[model samples]
Target chain A: MSAVATYVRLAWAWTRALAQYPASLAMLTAAQAVATVGELAALVFLFGHAGRLGGFGLHEALLVYGLAGLAFTLADLLMGSVERLGEHIRTGAFDVMLVRPVPALLQVAVEEFSPRRLGKVVPCAAALGWALAALPAEWTPLRAAAVPVLVASGTVICCSVWVIGACLQFVALDAREAANAVTYGGQAMAQYPLAVYGRDVARAATYVVPLAFVSWQPALYLLERPDPLGMPEWLRFAPPAVAALLALVAAAVWRAGLRRYRSTGS
Target chain B: MEAVIEAEGLGKDYTVAEGPLPRRRRRRVSAVRDVSFRVAPGEVVGYLGPNGAGKSTTLKMLIGILAPSAGRVRVAGLEPVRARTRLARRIGVVFGQRTTLWWDLPLRDSLALTRHLYRVPRADHARRLAELTEVLELGPFLATPVRQLSLGQRMRGDLAAALLHAPEVLVLDEPTIGLDVVSKTAIREFLLRLNAERGTTILLTTHDLGDVQRLCRRVMVIDGGRLAFDGGLAGLHAVAPSPRTLVVDLAAPAAPIAVAGARTVRVEGPRQWLELNGNPARVIAQVAADHEVADITLREPDIEEVVHRIYAGR
Candidate 1:
């Protein structure tokens, strides 16, 4: 029928792929929840001792952590397939994706809908929500003012990392962990106050890639605080523009890699 | 009949690396050398070659999977590499080694997914599935997980999956390589009906000669990454000169009875192998009825021998 209809069908199939394995999906979701809670124990201890680090209190830190965690895990669920894309190309598995009537990029993006990673995501989401409710603040206006921008920017950053990782595999099959290091490390460091990692790491993260925007910067505005660093207060919403730029650059890299794909020996 | 696929001087070159941490070196190998041909609509063509014969490379070129190193290919009026978006909708491919299926999902889920991806109408999907499952005997395994299927079962499912889209052109690579006799027969019969009844153009690359004999009227042979033979099956045989062989395993090894039109070759305990005069099927039938024969068989020379004969003549 229509091209959009075909994409919808393929996306449905990908979701069903996860549904087919209920136990795996359930287990992963629980694992993610537990991990997020476990990470919160650390957040609680660090924030309990010191009232604020780089001007972020307990609730604000949890806000950034939870949203970033959710976005990262959501992207991981699909992007895992993109990482294995090299092996797919090497084994000629990519050929199957190519023969379909849909766009190759769309087909590959939804190819893997992983269910297990939620073992960490659900807990992070809960912690973020819990932190939001427990804090003595106006909840309705805060979320309205910030959550959509938070989700969009976080998604763009995660999607950009996913594409970059996949593209790197196209060039060098063995460099997967290196890509993971940047993605996982970036998310972890950005979830907390940059003032903890000292000035250089925080500044590099702030202006260069702007990983801090997802959690650190925007949470400042929601929490109604000034920048812990000597920088201006408006840098809090900086992640979205950075996210958009990274997404565009990531897609460009992917197109270049597609041209360079030699495929398998056939 | 109009040509559904056309190719001119298509080629693929590959460079392989040698040595891990030792003296580094490299080698350049060509998987496909300038090959060209055309297939008429509603025609079934067989592509045959020994291992590493570039048959697969050429098929990939037609399907837009591999970009050709040189030359051009047009399948259904679209350039394979330059116009893949437009080309993908109208082609169905089955690479027997791969299922193109979701491993964890049920057979039906994967089928439904394909139906959606192809944008098949709900009514059309229901009818196609009913017709395909009937011919391929896929009902029993509809809800079963794909990871649990046997090779033959999977192969049949793959064939059925490929045909679901109702594409104008079908490309099958070694479609019946590991199937049991019953399944092989079913697949062959279904393919024949599809080509004749549905009028779909088919390009088949298979190791099984029986698959070629049963399904295709025209056969193309490639050797050493190059085109070796192209034309009808009759022309193919004429190119092979291993003196048509007739082998008979007798009930009693009745003394190598001198047949008028055939030359007797080797005689074993209960077997007699003979070189016949041109037509061996007629002689074998007559000899089988005349002699006290327990079992009889007629064999075309193996592909290797045929290739050898063609080379010798050259």
Candidate 2:
């Protein structure tokens, strides 16, 4: 049949498989809810007493937090273990991906689905509402449309980092824990204001990996604030723009890595 | 003869590098080199090699999973890796070490999925599943989660899963590597039938030599990333027309008639194996006449011995 048709069929199979383990799925979902809500509660506790840290109020921090949580959860839930590309690539399972008759990224992207991530996705939406209610906002149609678009862009950027991390596994099979700095660490740090860090580091993150686009800058535009970092308004939409660039760059790296994927024995 | 699969001058090179804390490229390692082979339609050819041999690499190239550094490959008149969706519909692949079937899903669901993924007709799916379930003996575990099934049961299910698409070509890498004897035999028999009746061309890379002897008529042996030998299984082991093995069920341990024409290959708890090296008719007649034969059985010189002898250069 068609490629889209095949994806749908396999995705159905994936969902059905997730349905088989109801208790595990429930536990995972609950754990995600607990994690997301727990993190938000910690933010409230810390910032409630402190008043403001990094120029972000408790409610404003939730904006960055909720968006990042939603983006990461959506990508993680669909891609499953692909978020752990460094590990999979270090092992030889990545080779199985290369030999299949589809685009390697497409195959990797569709590899696993985690329903437990719905725990975080739903909570993120709830937190977004809470944050919006707590903080006054000028909600134009453009700003409203930018929310999910930004989330999608952030997901793409995060996935790009994952793909790049996977490509690096060819050189350092174990990923030297540095790959995590790009993937999981980047995800964790992306939810906060990049301005919290030094100019050099934030610039590196913004220009090199471009993770800052996912939240910090876009939050600037949505919050209608002065350019604290002195970047253009368009720069806040860097999540999608950088995601697009990173995606192309990631495809190139994947191709280069495929040329370099020396398959190992079982 | 039309080639369903072809590869020429296939080679893969990997860089081995060590650098700073984050990004560095400095090392070089060549995994496969100068490998070439062709598989014709309806032919069951075994790709045999020891550990570290480039069998998986070759299979990857054929399947379009890996892009060769320098070479060309075509499967069933198409570039599989480049046209994966088309190839997915035309071929079935199974990795013995890992199951593609979902762990939580039942065998039926997995099979139903294969049917849908391959876009098999509804009636065709039912008919094929029923036949495979019977042939692979998957009836008992059809509704059970694939994870819950024993290794043998899971293997049988995987075999059926790979065949659901009725792929014109089946690339089985280590298909029976760790199966029980019964499971192995059942898979072998099924593969033999598949090739005979449906003319499904099979290129199997297996560590299990018995699979080669029983299921594959021709064999390709690769060593150190290169094609070492590509020919018939029998020619790999030179023998003087010793058609059958004399498995003498001796009445007693010392129930020896003579060991002149054949070699006593093994002596187990209660039985003895004689590799009938000479004329089968003469050996059988002489043994029957001389010994009080309680019972006797015949066996074939397996591809295991042949491949072992070849590897050892005996």
Candidate 3:
């Protein structure tokens, strides 16, 4: 069988095992969905009081928030096991991957498959749909088509950040906190309008972390808004290109980390 | 016979950071040094060592989990480091400290996953699973979750999981560490049968002397990151010669019995302890002929004593 097939089989088996505990799985999924709903409520109240923050109306801001949440949650569903790489390294459980014929990254990605994460997807997608229906912007055929592509590119960018965090676990096994700062922190910052942040924070999001490409830049294009920072208009279409570059860099870092790996003590 | 596994001066050094944060220093600790050995097809070799004696480190290198800091190793004619994925198809590894089977999944499911991972043919997988289930007595708990099984049952499950792919060489570290006598015997018997019937090459690191005595014809003893002895079990006695103790209860308390072939190490009111370097039978005969003996018992040296003697001699 091919590597992809094997990973799929492995993931399917885990899903079946998780299904054995239906009640707990349902509770976990509900908990995640409820938390996201609460966050959406907070956004609604904030927009209700202020009317417009950083020149983005309630529906436009909701679009950005919904897109950010969808991208991050999807990435988390696929690559969230990367967060446990530090624990695997510390406990020597990662050696199991080394002894297998399959790629270690694939094994790690499939090692922990959370069916509960499907819960967050429902709320985020609903919010995105509501925003798209209520927004006043012209829904041209090209613009309508760009939404899925942007969401996909955004997911790829978020997954790259997760892969990079997993790679860093090899060098610093206890750096989970630092890795979370980039992954979760990036997601938190990407949900807001880039114009709301200071110049330095916005620059870091664009240049240093590139999380702006995940939602903000694409939102600008889809919303037909101008760059508040006076940047080039072409930057709005850069998500796909930026995501590809980040994925390449993340793969290189992963390979370097594997080369330097030393299995934990027996 | 062709050699199935080979190592030439294989060693591993770990650089561990020491001291407090800002002033932390790196120190290199040699876990294994200049350890070289070979195992032929159909051979059962025992790897023996004390704690921190590098046995586990050497096994890790051979399995391709840990790359050696120096020298080289080859399993089934491939360098483990460069061809780890290829090598994995030809070898199976079991660490007694952990289970390779999924914790929440059933044993049968875990075995099925292994079959898929190795891409075993459907018919062959069925045959192998049946045979292993019978030999390892896995039928009783095949559907039970791994976490719910007993230690012995879990070990059996792990063994079956490892062999489902029919790996040419099986590398086991402490395969019988915590098993009860019944479980250990069952495992030992299964291993012996597997080697004899299938001609599988076996290399196991264990502290269990019973496992060594019953399964391995040849043994390798390592200490302080190096090979201390590599020969038959009898030859181990020569390297670390430990006296056999003979306890005799005399008719009455007498002067320290002057036996030529034995040394009187201790004396109680009506009992005497004699240490014999040569044949215990001859010493017993000599003592029996000279004095009236009530009861006698002999004690052979344990594995720990033999290992201790070897380390002390070094």
Candidate 4:
């Protein structure tokens, strides 16, 4: 079987095991739904008081917010289990993964693929749909085509960040929280218009982290607006390029970390 | 025959941080150093070592779980680290202390996933699983979640999971570390059968002397992260120089008997125990010539005693 097929099979096995605890799974799924809904409520409440956030109106900002959230949700669904690498390393479970014929990365990513995370997508996709319906921009074929590309590139970019962050667990097994600060924290930052942050902070997001390409750059193009920080116009279409490069870097980092692994004493 | 498993100058050095937060010191500790050995195909070799003697580290290097700090290792003609995935298809590993089976999934489900991971054909997988289940007595608990199985049952499941792909070589790290006597015996028997029927090359590290006595014809004793002794089991017994004890019942009570090839270590009412380092027959004959003997018995040192002596001396 191919790696992806094996991943799905492993993940499905876990999901079935999880389904054994129906009540707990239901409660967790409902909890995730409520949490995301609460976030959406807070965004709406904030926009109720102000006319616009960072020059984008409530609907415009919502488009950016929705796109970022959808991408993050998908990335989390696909690669969230990589966060458990620290626990696996601590308990020597990572060593078990290494001995398998399958790639250890695939094993780690699908270790506990929770279906509970699927709840977050409902609210995120709903928000994106609402924004698309409410926005006043003329729907050109090029502009309409950019939406799915934006989300795809954004999901890939977020997955790269997730994996690269997970690689740090190889050196500092206790640094899981520190890695989360960059990934989850970056997601929180990406869910907003870049104009709301200070000039240098937005610049860092553009060049250093490239999180701006996740939603802000493409959303600017989708909304037919000007760049607040005056980045190159070509960067709006550059998320795919950026995502590809980051994926390569993430793969390399993962390989290096695997080599550095110090398996625990039996 | 070509060696199925080979290691040349294999070593691992760990740089560990020690001391308090204010003044930490980094010390280089050698876990394994300049260790090398080989196992021919279909050979069952016992890898005996004390705790923390680099047994697991050596096994990990051979299985490609750890990249050796210095030296080289090959199993089935592939460098372990570079061709780990390829080598994995040829080698099966079981760590007695840990289970590779999914904790919450049923044993059968884990085995099914293993089938996919190793890309075994369904017909082959079913046949192998059936044979393993019968041999390991895993049928009753096949549907039970691994987390709920007893330690012995879980271990049986682990063994089956490892063997489902029918690897050419099996590397076991303490395969009988924790188990009831019956369970241990059963696992040992299964392993012996696996070797005999399939000609699978077996390398195992164990603290249990019974496992060594029953399964391994050749033994390698590692100490201080080095290959201290490697040869047949009889050679390992010779490393300790422990003597055989001879017990003789005399026709009547007498003072410590004078003998040429033996020394009287203990004396009782009508018997004496002599420590004999040479031919027991000659010593018994000499004692018989000096005095009438009722009966005699000789005891050789057990493998455990010889192994303990080796560890303590090292």
- Candidates in order, TM-scores: namely 0.86, 0.84, 0.90, 0.89
List the pairs of residues colliding in candidate 1.
A1-B119, A28-A119, A29-A118, A29-A119, A31-A119, A32-A119, A32-A120, A33-A119, A33-A123, A217-A236
lDDT of 1: 0.78
User: Each model's fnat?
Assistant: 0.66, 0.47, 0.64, 0.89
Best by DockQ: 4
TM-score of predicted structure 1: 0.86
Error of 2 at B191 (Å): 1.9
Prediction 4 global C-alpha lDDT: 0.89
Runs in model 1 deviating more than 4 A are A1-24, A50-55, A131-143, A203-210, A221-235, B20-28, B242-300
List interface RMSDs for the candidates, in order. Answer: 1.9, 3.2, 1.1, 0.8
lDDT of 2 by residue, A1-266 (tens): 46666666666677778877789879988998998888878877887998887787888888888777777777666654554555556555665555344455655666665667788889888877787666567778988888778888878877777778767766666773777677778778877766667677677777887877777776777788765666667787566768888889988987787655556655
**Would you list the C-alpha lDDT of every candidate in the order shown?**
0.78, 0.76, 0.88, 0.89
Per-residue lDDT tens digits for candidate 1, residues A139-240, read 677556677777678777877877887789777877778877878878788677676777778688776666776666666666666666667776766677
**Model 4 pairs whose backbones collide:** none
Ranking by lDDT: 4, 3, 1, 2
Instruction: Give the per-residue Cα lDDT of candidate 2 at A254.
Output: 79
User: How many clashes (backbone atoms < 3 Å, residues ≥3 apart in a chain or on different chains) does model 4 have?
Assistant: 0
DockQ winner between candidates 1 and 2: 1
Give the range where candidate 2 chain A is weakest over 10 consecutive residues by summed lDDT.
Answer: A95-104
What TM-score would you give candidate 2 relative to the actual structure? 0.84
